[model samples]
Target: MTEKNKTTNNGTSRRDFLKSASMAAAGFMIVPRHVLGGRGFIAPSDMLNVAGIGAGGKGQSDIAAFAKSGKANIAYLCDVDDRRAAASRASFPKAKYIKDWRDLLEKEHKNFDAVSVSTPDHNHAIIAYHAMQLGKHVYVQKPLTHDIWEARLLTEAAKKFKVVTQMGNQGASNDGTRLMAEWYDADLIGDVHTVYCWTNRPVWPQGIQWPTNKSEVPKELDWDLWQGTAPRKEYVDKLVPFNWRGWWDYGTGALGDMGCHLVEAPFRVLGIQYVKDVQASVGSVYVDEFKKGVFPESCPPSSHITLTFPKTNKTKGDVTLHWMDGGIQPERPDELGPSEPWGGEEGNGTLFIGTKGKMFASTYSDAATLLPKERTKDAKAPQKYKRVPGGANGHYAQWVEACIAGYGKMEVSSPFEVAGPLTEALLMANLAVRGHDLKGGALKYTWDNKAMKVTNFDAVNKYVKREYPAGFELKA
Candidate 1:
């Protein structure tokens, strides 16, 4: 038995089968891994060699998880900040380390079979797109890309490149998500028409002006590489590892931070597609004497955005999903005792309203409960969906295994086909948030998903596709 087949435990090696299958099915020569010395090469052992693009924080933990999957070898680690890269470097001591992903992919693409992108939101698309272009599978952090256009581009690129892809929304693989689906399929929650996904995120800063005083760029950091795709700006204090989540240039605000995790369950259970329209109401920050302030560059202090999705196989009509963030939450349903704790300990949760009854789940779709609590106690439904092994934490292994099996050969929970539109929905809601300041506070924005524009508000369309800085075009 080949070493790869031993790990697969299915008697047939994935790559071996994919190689022969490609030739037989295509009836033509499909370049084998051995020929891709300038791209990604599959090892003779069948182990997938992976490169970590932002090897710190979530990136660091992601590599560790991939390494834990036993199917992946962490071959290369790259990050703009050496300080952030330290732990991953220590853990994967044998892996080569680089400071720039562009250099790593350009110089060492041949050594790796896949790339895991866990960079700041603004940089996710550029890195993931390039990796896919090189025929490397990618696992990108949510929300998929910084802007709407990037998400659409990466989604198409995934199909065009024919490489395996997964988003970093681990909850998509959780048992709770499947449980919800089983219940919905069984009519336990009959045709959910509304979903409320809320979070207390922005544990980082938002709704504030950019730091006026530029700080010294850390000696351990490469500011230029970290600023990839976004227009370059002077370095500021403490924005490196986490605070970037709150800035428009660096992050996509709370919706971007938690939307993928919170929204994935509803999107899956209800079979949500691209959003049809959106409207938002955001909390204002006090600026100073006698004025409310709108810091356009930073995410608002809090927001309640309602998104409308076209009906799908699961819904009778349109589906409305409400997203609340920044410590805001929806009214507790009567199903639970007044004293019972809600969604996350941090007051986050997701609720689905259907014709028969309502159901709720905790953050990341954990711990689902039917309305009235008693229904949850008496709930019974055939498990229609197979649980991903290891649930939420299993997401890493799921992607690793899929990459080995080859693209289109395995079912990953949050592939680009799924993550891209999910991301577009969140970014669409953000359009309402950002455009609230424009057109004398327009209350609603009707989206043309086919056109990827706002039909009602022409001014907000500029954000549909942002201009990449010089030398940072989305290329083939």
Candidate 2:
């Protein structure tokens, strides 16, 4: 069992809590809201008191969604940058505010029943793990963690802690994923041996050297807290709010930003669990006519990655999933008409190429349609899966209600069990992306998922489990 579940803040192990709660439940009948109040119903007195870390930007929207549910009371807000957090502070006037998440979780953990972490990729696992250790239900934004080791650890931690957990890949709750699954189960697409997911991301700056001129850290922002697990470095111009997605230290690049949304459907439809190997080719930037640029700190402007997943029940053989980013896209299928839109105008989508036919969907699994226009127009399949009410938008309330309902009593669309491996797949793919920066000519990185290392390139394995800064270790 994980240390988190072995002993909680209340001095009661999850096993103890279960034994006692079960005994209590035997004598006292606890009625679920769906039975006593009704679906989408919550008693005001039983509202879930939520604490949000990184409560700004996407975090702001996440917390707001919980508030909109009316069953979640935003009890506390935390963010390193006051400038970015201003909107959320004003939105939740009654929420007590703190800048450091460690302080928030340490001092105010009991004040809130659950925690929402929407921070950068680097610090996600640490904060989320601590919250779970406190026996608090957790809602973490996607890509789950910065490294493959962290992803595997968090996945195991969630099950061991016996805590209700959810990854903020809202698309997991989308009807589109279910619809695609229904079609696939009906053999509409037959066995999907190949899949393609692409996105026009890194809309931010990438594939460049770090700014030589370091900028002054904003007075309103606590740069140290923002850097969390990342090594201390001088703050640069405009790194806050969003551009961090392009950096290797703080973000997971385009794949981290859109992979969960774009790759989730294929995972669900094909039952992909773990990736076996990965290889990538990245777009390079020209610093000048005389020299090729090499910036190890930033993600490339674009990349095309290939991941091989072992055979699953849904596939006749192994599956090869292609991931492209930075405006790179796959060739239009012949079945698609000349004028038909490819992967949608949003410049992000997933296409499943199977033995019998092909299916495509936009990011977040929306706008799913069978290819060959005529086939989509003529196809019909039985609904074999239950659709999440409100689809992607329901992801927030689903967590809120589940938190209030207690662990194991409620179901979430993107629980750690599913999101964990999906995230590992993305991170493993990233291992190849980062590996491209190696001095060697080229190599296909065979992944030993069990060992959490790239078997072919020992040098690149350093990125699989990064060294944490002092006081920021990830515990099992």
* Clash pairs (backbone) in predicted model 2: none
Worst 10 residues of 2 by lDDT: 9-18
lDDT tens readout by residue for model 2, 1-476:
44554433222223433233324323443343344542333443489878899888899999999999988988899998998889999999988899867657654554567889999989899888877766778999998989888888888878877778999999999999999998899999888999999998979999988888978878898777788788878889888888998999999999999999999998999999899988899998888998879899999999999999999988889999999999999999999777878776889999999989999998898888997766777788998888887899999999888888788988899999999999999998988888877863267889887888888789988988899764565656
- Candidate 2 is scored at a TM of 0.90
- TM-score computed on alpha carbons, candidate 1: 0.91
lDDT, candidate 1, 270-299, per-residue tens: 899799889999988888888998788888
TM-score of each: 0.91, 0.90
RMSD for all candidates, in order, please. Answer: 8.8, 6.9
lDDT accuracy of residue 291 in candidate 2: 82
Top candidate on lDDT is 2
Q: Pick the candidate with the highest TM-score.
A: 1
lDDT of 2: 0.84
